[model samples]
Target: MRIAIVNPNTTQSMTQAAAASAGSAARSDTVLIEVTASTGVASVESHVDEAWGALSVVTEIERCEASAERPDAYVVACFGDTGVSAAREAAAGPVVGMTEAALMTASLVAHRFAVITMPKRTLRQSEQVVRNLGLEHRCTVLAVDETVAELAEGSLHLLDLFTAEGRLALDAYDAEAIVLGCAGLADLVGPLQAALGVPVIEGVAAAVTIAEGLVAQSLTTSRALTWARSSSPSEAVSA
Candidate 1:
């Protein structure tokens, strides 16, 4: 199976980081394609960036059109899951957002979860997304006192910083699992899990698993559904 790991950021490093994490767990036959948004925020950290970055989600699908085989799944590798609904609408395969996938997986593992985001401005967005997805009943949003760019800048030591923050989010909040609310932190889940003694879910890894599971079940967004097609054109970017 082929999977597209679309990073909704212009940063190549961030795109590569997401691809690496997802690729590690992908099936041997799964071709994990990595691509960055052609135009958008360098890193998604705030509501403004989330809204703007959401627009660039279709960039990868547009680019992949030239290829002989389209990817079996499209993964929006930002924690906000900016344009997941639209991507699903536009694609023949499944389009899963990292945040949505992580939350779904977290729900299956634990009764409650605390999402650890990068910036304070993102906490509201995270909460809004959880509510929008009907997971607010089981999740709370938390923010790290740092930005995603800061994490990438000192990536060599990110594991330590993330573990410390993830532990605090879990124990302090009494959360059963901690969702990594930034795609850039996908690689730190194992360390964070060890440190917190709870599941630390990352969007990249979560999205891939969800996509594969959907494929296994031969599932895709229904074209006949009113809500899927009745969305306004202005709201349509990709699904």
Candidate 2:
């Protein structure tokens, strides 16, 4: 199976990091195609950044669709799952979002999951994701000491901060699982999970795994409901 991994941020390093993690988790026969957004913020930090990054992600999806070797599934690498609905509509195959995959993966292993994210600005967006997934009762959103941009730059100090916050979520909030709330923090999943002694869901890896399942099952997002085409059939063709 072929899978397309779209990194919504403009930074190629972030795309590389996402690809590395996804590659490690994916099956040996699965072919992975990684694409970085050509235009957007270096890192998606706020809702506004997510909004702008979405357009770039959609563009990449279109490009993938028109490619000679199109993917059987698509994975939006952003923790926010930016542009996922749009991409699902445009593609013929399944599209998986990082946030949804992580939360779903967490739910299977633990009843209560807490997200450990960056600074304060992105907390509400993560909360919105929980609410959208109907996981508000099962999940909590928390932040670490670093900003989104800082983590993308590979800050060593923030790893400890994330571990500390993960501990708090486990001990204080009584969380049974932790979801890493930023794609930038994907590399720290193993260490954090080991230290906390609980399941740690990294969005990128989770999304890749979910995408693989959907592809194997020959399933894609249902266009008959939430993602139904907005334009008329004729209008869609004319455009």
lDDT of 1 by residue, 62-168 (tens): 55744798888888888878777767766778888888888888999999888888777777777877998898878988777677887564353666766776677
Residue pairs of candidate 1 with colliding backbone atoms: 86-238, 86-239, 87-238, 87-239, 88-239
| Candidate 2, residue 104: how far the Cα is off, in Å | 0.3
Model 2 TM: 0.94
The predictions' CA RMSDs to the true structure, in order, are 3.5, 2.1
In model 1, state the lDDT of residue 171: 72
Q: Tell me how far the alpha carbon of residue 132 in candidate 2 is from the true structure, in angstroms, after superposition.
A: 1.0
| Best-fitting candidate, scored by lDDT | 2
Instruction: Report lDDT per candidate.
Output: 0.79, 0.85
The candidate that wins on TM-score is: 2
Error (Å) of candidate 1 at residue 229 is 5.5
- Give candidate 2 regions above 4 Å deviation: 230-239
Lowest lDDT 10-mer window, candidate 2? 227-236
